[model samples]
Target: MSFMIPSAIKISSQFDAGNIEVLDLTNPQDIQLSIRKDNQSDFFQWFHFRVQGAANQPLTLRVLNAGQAAYVDGWPDYRAVASYDRETWFRVDTAYEADTGELVIQHTPAQNSIYFAYFAPYTWEQHLDLIAQAQQSALCEVHDIGTTLDGYDLNLLKISKPTESEAPAKKQIWVTARQHPGETMAEWCAEGFIARLLDEDDALAQSILEQAEFYVVPNMNPDGSIRGHLRTNACGANLNREWETPTAERSPEVLAVRSLMQQTGVDLFLDLHGDEALPCNFIAGQEGAPHLPDTILAQEDRFKQDLAQINPDFQLERGYPPGKFGPETFTIAAFWVGREFNCPSMTLEMPFKDYDNRPDADFGWSPERSIKLGESMLYPIHQWLQADL
Candidate 1:
């Protein structure tokens, strides 16, 4: 009988809530949002905002700058996540008015405080929890290869059978994410991969642990990821670019991960990522890597073709223009291990926007889809790793 109409909060494109100030909230039901462009840089894809005091009202928040945002194309069919406790994020109905360049979101808050993001964020705390949880698994081993400039551990998680045996038949598989810290969906994909690999009912998982060892670095840029940055490390260095020649001063994450990859010898490697421009899920390979062997190229193509058949969400329609090995297109996924190891390595890019071919505004290319992709990868990989294949 008594409903409380709490106040509202403004939104912005900036990360830290302090740098940009709020304008109005009195009209909570009809709120407006704006994006503040980075004056020193041309980046404006990141957004973080808060809504205060709207405890019980169904707030219809509108971001009028959606169409003008740096990657305006990413908003057409998307759902934004919101949380009453910042710990649990669920999607809300969001429609992008293409003609008006507006993003309209509707949500009714249960508490005075609320938080939202492009996806359910896997915060730094969650990363630490993942490390701790994996360490406790009998099939899991934790190795600290090196430390970042910030003194944080450059972590590596090795998962395999626990029995004592000299011949660990487990084929070596490696997965790393967050080379670009702002692409949080990468980590979500990693989460799904690790979860499926650890599932008890998963016979494929059981066989994988017995026949192959998995090395995962779920968060490669913890400092940048935690600092709410779109890309680059704490010192503003992009880790992906530093892979070919990683140094402690600039990029210890790549250094540690690459060192382990060489030691174990990567049979299969997947670098998870999110693309701002591309609206479809696809795989980018090292076909252009100078003198890439015929066998590895075949494996890469086979894997993509198989995944497309398994999941309708993934397609090979659009992706980065293929480039020959050179400084211009040097990426961790393209040139580093693929060239150095001469193995079947790839970069699996999910879209920040929904999978256009089969769009679901309620979910989009979301945490759920990321997880499914992780699961679907196992089948193709298993088939490829077969002795005959």
Candidate 2:
């Protein structure tokens, strides 16, 4: 009698920004898996995991609960990202079956281990590294504004070039990203923006720093990010929706940042994000807010036009239609800030999938592109400030 022994294959998701639930791993060709929901919430979609002991072997990963996720439309045209060195992420073969409600990923690992995610993940450790890097520049100041429910620090970066003479007050520019923890592209964009702002040789950056001060929150929901939640913090509160009336227990992140904004007084505000369904980059304004002035509305239009001209990746044609928020307008961060400060407050949304007009087959809507878009934003900002003068 002869007996066949099963091969050893292991899967894990215990690291930072990792979320998955394994069902069956007996057969690498038919591995069964499911995405874990955010803590204390029903929303599930973000997934990151690792496969070990499977070098040069064909494998298939199936998420059985993909259809029940927060955004079903995000699956149809989506391709999952994979990495070997964790530094370079590339797109792999992915398909969605509507009937079975399954998301399938097929790949043959060239090495012994591989990591996969909904998109290229920006880890919590990476966030700390970014903060530390920014603080090394004499132009940047780091502040521990508050703490999350999970006992993590909430950090804010203030960047400006000091002048010896008593010049007129500079414009206060506020930029924040990653209010929804799953949208990792937002933080990536923030990284690029911060890097260019701190560049000593860049003429555009130096010119902007001479006239304006920057207040940036690179990762707004660290607890949710580390916990692998899609849209909420430790206690299941969406920070964006809590801007109108934030509390200490439910959303201390928003409470701390919003209080600081009130104290500092914003001249221009931007909240960065990633849209699950949109395939192109665009901006969504606060047109739904009550009592919006003509001047503020015109300023928003001019800023959009300037950005569209500066960055080819950004467009003006497609986005959330006007009045998309309806009665809940004030609850949103952009809308609340626009109404409160009467400035050009906007949400810059990147796509999870490839940009439809100019898609890259190997790497779709990647971190490099996000970072370039962030660097490109300085041009429009400089133009806006120059026009005012």
Give lDDT tens digits, candidate 1, residues 135-234.
Answer: 8777778888887766777788888776566864567889999887768889888877887887778997886666778899998987766656566676
Q: Model 2 Cα RMSD, Å? A: 2.7
lDDT of 2 by residue, 105-181 (tens): 99999998899999899999999999999999999999999999999999999999996588878999999999999
Worst 10 residues of 1 by lDDT: 12-21
What is the model-wide C-alpha lDDT for candidate 2?
0.93
Q: lDDT per model, in order?
A: 0.74, 0.93
Off by over 4 Å in 1: 1-42, 56-72, 85-111, 162-170, 324-326
The clash tally of candidate 1 reads: 4
Per-candidate TM-score against the hidden true structure: 0.83, 0.97
Worst 10 residues of 2 by lDDT: 285-294
Q: Which candidate is the best by TM-score?
A: 2
Please state the error at residue 52 of candidate 2 in Å.
Answer: 0.7
